[model samples]
Target: MPTHLIIHGRVQGVFYRDWTVSTARRLGVSGWVRNLPDGTVEAHLEGSPDAVEAMIGKMRDGPPAARVERIERSEAKAQGAEGFKRR
Candidate 1:
């Protein structure tokens, strides 16, 4: 299964996307992350259930500079992405 997440709060310009890519790749999760115009970060994570859940937890904390206020997640079909990316 895949998980889609919307991370809100001081996430932009705080290396959130870069951190997400590094964390997801380190966890061997395949997905894409991007910044939304609404100042939120969005991501699609796909991997083993454990890895996906781990990534979600990481998203909540984000980088040291990120002040993660909240995170929203939902299930989605896996897209077979080969690696984590920032879009």
Candidate 2:
């Protein structure tokens, strides 16, 4: 299944995107993560149900330097994402 997430908090400039790429790749999840102008991090995660859920849990905590406030998630159609990337 695929999931889209809008993560809010001290996500940008905290290595959040880099961490996400590492974590997602490690979990074998394929998608992209980017920093929104509104200071939130947006991501499209596509993988196994368990992997996606695990990624969500990790996003809630973010990187050690990040203070994740909340994460908004929704179902999305897979886009045949090949690998995790930071955008």
Candidate 3:
């Protein structure tokens, strides 16, 4: 199953999107992360349950400069994400 995560707070302009792309790649997760106009970071990650969870866990702490405040997670239907990207 795939998972979608919407992270809020201090997530933009801090390399969060870039870090998410690299981190997800390292964890072998497929999906994308983007910066919302409202200053939130949204991501869609697909992989094994464990891998997805790992990615989410890291997102909660983002880069050392990031201060993640809230993470909303929900199960998502697989969308066949080809690779990790930042947007």
Candidate 4:
């Protein structure tokens, strides 16, 4: 199943999005992550269930500089993501 996540907290300007993209690509996951105007980071990932879960876990703990507060996730339809992107 595909997974969609909306992460909130101090997750911007600290290389959060860039780190996420790198991690996702390394995991061979297809999706995109972007910075929201509300200071939150939203990402959509599609791959093996286990891989997606692992990515979510990493997102919760992000990079050393990231202070993730909460991450909301749910199942979503895959749109055939081209690659991990920033926006």
Clash tally, candidates in order: 0, 0, 0, 0
Q: After superposition, how far is residue 83 of candidate 4 from its true place, in Å?
A: 2.4
Candidate 3 TM-score over all chains jointly: 0.96
Clashing pairs in 4: none
Per-residue lDDT of 1-87 in model 3, one digit per residue for the tens?
A: 698888998988899999999999999999998888888888999998899989888889999999998999888888899889887
Candidate with best lDDT: 2
TM per candidate = 0.97, 0.97, 0.96, 0.94
Query: Candidate 1 on 1-87: residue-level lDDT in tens?
Result: 898899999999999999999999999999999999999999999999999999898888999999999899889888989999999
lDDT measured at residue 11 in model 1 versus the true structure, 0 to 100: 99
Q: Per-residue lDDT for 31-60 in model 2, tens only?
A: 999999999999999999999998899889
- Lowest lDDT sum, 10 consecutive residues, model 4, at 78-87
Q: lDDT winner between 1 and 4, please give it.
A: 1
If the candidates were sorted by their TM-score against the true structure, best first, what order would they fall in?
2, 1, 3, 4
Model 4 CA deviation exceeding 4 Å by range: none
Ranking by lDDT: 2, 1, 3, 4
Model 2's number of clashes is 0
